[model samples]
Target: MKIHNFSSGPSILPKEVLQKASEAVVNFNNSGLSLIEISHRDPAFVEVLNAARSLTLELLDLKDKGYSVLFLQGGASMEFVRIATNLLNKKAGYINTGNWANNAQMEASFIGEVQEIASSKDRNYSYIPKSIHIPQDLDYVHITSNNTIYGTQYSEFPTVDVPLVCDMSSDLFSRVLDFSKFDLIYACAQKNAGTSGVNLVVIKNDILGKIEREIPNIMNYSKHIEKESMYNTPAVFSVYVSYLTLNWIKDKGGIAAMERRNRAKAHLMYSEIDRNSLFYGTAQQQDRSIMNAVFYLNEPRLTTLFDDWCIKNSIYGIKGHRTVGGYRASMYNALPIESVQHLVGVMQHFEESI
Candidate 1:
């Protein structure tokens, strides 16, 4: 049976990307050496790394004057601490949207004075907060561009005079973004970029030398920028694969094409949920996530049955986050329309059978 994958991270990737990666793993670029065994310093590997970094900037339409892109080892979790240590001087403002935002805020607190300017915690993050007040004296304002687990996303970023730092792990390349608006944007590659192992950081050039805190060389963004993200050996294989994925995105017409596909996939699932009498969506209609759709059967008893039915039908990873238990269909960039149609059919079948 051809299975459909809906896992949020280490999630689905383009079929062509996977096939190309598999070939490279055995004989990279016809070098007759597996990509895993190639030296990071090798010309082949360096080309891959440089291409990945360059393509990232090109896709985001970023100019060289103000921005620097770094492919780092630690995931976005590490960036939470790094951002605070590097950017937060006296105080920082953060919008607490969901679990990941709260986690990022927690890490920032350990480094300096941090304040939750606005939060959706009261409503269990079902909706995005309308306003965030950034204090003029604060160093930077942080926002999670998309809430992966809570099924909420910011349609428009909060406007603040201060620098804006965003953790865009889940929705980094899914839509077109104004790269200039943010001082910093970091994301773990597992979601839309590639598999787990590498994280991408795009930071403003001006923020590099302004920090007062004694940040370690490894944690410092400036050091990574200076070294060209070759500070350590770097995740060579992951970076290579990420390069392939970015190339795939470019071949598919860049972010504009991706936005149309993503919007269509989300509309397909949400339309079914709205029309279906036996199922209900969990997140607020206006703030519903395009990446992850959270919904559940009207009859509580059918939850387990529905989950089992999905598994039996070779539909995978539709289970919701444990904290917000229900059904979550993570329609990532690489997930085909057919997979989503299968899921919708499953939902319709369950509704009829029940």
Candidate 2:
């Protein structure tokens, strides 16, 4: 039986992208060398990097907007440090939405002052904080566009006078947004983009050079930009697979089409959680993430039964994070609506049987 993958990270990817990537691993572009075996400086790999960067800008509609795209080593977790090292000259404001948001603030605090401008921690991060007061004195404001574990997303981004930086690791290419609103956006490729090991960072050219701290060459965004994301040997396989996925997104009509598809899946998943008497959603309805639909079984004792049912039906990766124990149906871009329908069918069957 086929598995319905709902893994939060290192999640589902387009089948076509996978097929092409697998082929390249053995023999890239009909050449005898595997993609992983090729030198990072090889002209073919360089073209892939350049094309991927250009495609990212094109899809975000950010071309010629004084923005530069870099697929750098390390994950978004690494970016937390890089972002602070390069940008945090003075204090920065961070909106603590979930675990990742809090971690980002903690990382930045070690570099300089960090103010928790807004937070929903009082409610266990079940909802997004609506009332936010960003201080004008802040060097920049940081936010996680979507909380994968909490299943909450920013329906509308906070308006800030200071430069805006967003860690959109989980929901970067899964929705359509006004990309120009952010001065910097970083995303790990493991979720909607590709496998782990690479992070995509889009920086506005003007955001650099203001900090007085001596940023080491490796941690400096400006240095990475100067080398075009090749300051060090890049994650070759991850970047290539991500390039293929980007091509898939463009061919499928870009971000607008992705938003519509994701909305449909979320609606179906959340609708089941609401309508079914056996279950209820964990996150606030208004702030529910289109990428991750988190819910809980009303009869906690039936957890094992539900897990068994899901596994029997070839449904996997529906378990929630430890912080919020229950279930989380991650409906990413590559997750077909049919999979959501299948999971709903399982929910209905389990409810009826009980």
Candidate 3:
């Protein structure tokens, strides 16, 4: 049976990207050395780094716009700390949408004062907070673009006077957006971009060197940019995979094309969740994520039955987060619409049988 991967992180990649990356793993650029075994400083690897950076800026249309792209080691979680260290001078503001947003806020508190400008946690993070007020005193405002665990996302990012920072980990390349609005944007490569072990950080050059607190070279974004994202040894394999994926996105007509495909997949999945009597969505209809759709079986007793049916049909990783305790079908940029159609077929058939 063909597997339909719905795993959230280290999630789906284009089949072509996987094929190309696998070939490189065995013999990179037709050289006998495996991509993982090559020296980071070797011209071959350096070219990969340069191309990755160049392509990233090109796709975002941020070329020559005073923004620098860096593929640094450590997942988006590491950025929770590095962002505060480099940017937070006296205070920062965060919009708390879900688990990841809450974690980002908590981590920034360790560095300085953190004001939760607005939050949807009062309603179990089922909706996006609106009419957010960003104080002028804040050094920057931070937000997680999408909540994978809760299946909520910001439909439109808030307008703020302060420097805006976004963690676009889950939905980085899945849609079109005004990429220039945010002063700093960071994402883990495990989702739509590529696999694990690396994070992409795009920073505007002017935001640094303002903080009074001393930052270690390792945690400093300025230092990383200064070294051209090679301040130390980088995540070789992960970055290479990310480069391939970026190429795939560009060839597929950039983020606009991705948005159309992703919307279709989301509509397919959410339509089933709504029409089928067996299940209902968790997040508010307006706030539901196109990337990860969280829903639950109406009849809790039928949970095991549905799980068994999905497994028998080769559907995997549809289990919801423990916090939500239901089902989540993550529809990423590369998840073909057919997989969603398959899941919907299972849902409809199971509903009728039950």
Greater lDDT among 1 and 3 belongs to 3
Runs in model 1 lying further than 4 Å from the true structure: none
Task: Tell me how candidate 3 scores on lDDT.
Answer: 0.92
Q: Give candidate 2 regions above 4 Å deviation.
A: none
Q: Pick by lDDT: which candidate is best? A: 2
How far off is model 1, as Cα RMSD? 1.0
Predicted candidate 2 versus true structure: per-residue lDDT over 130-200, tens digit per residue: 86877899999999999999999999999998889999999998898999999999999988888898999
lDDT of every predicted structure (CA atoms): 0.89, 0.93, 0.92
Cand. 1 TM to true fold:
0.98
Cand. 3 TM to true fold: 0.99
Cα miss at 8, model 2 (Å)? 0.5
Off by over 4 Å in 3: none
lDDT of 3 at 10: 77
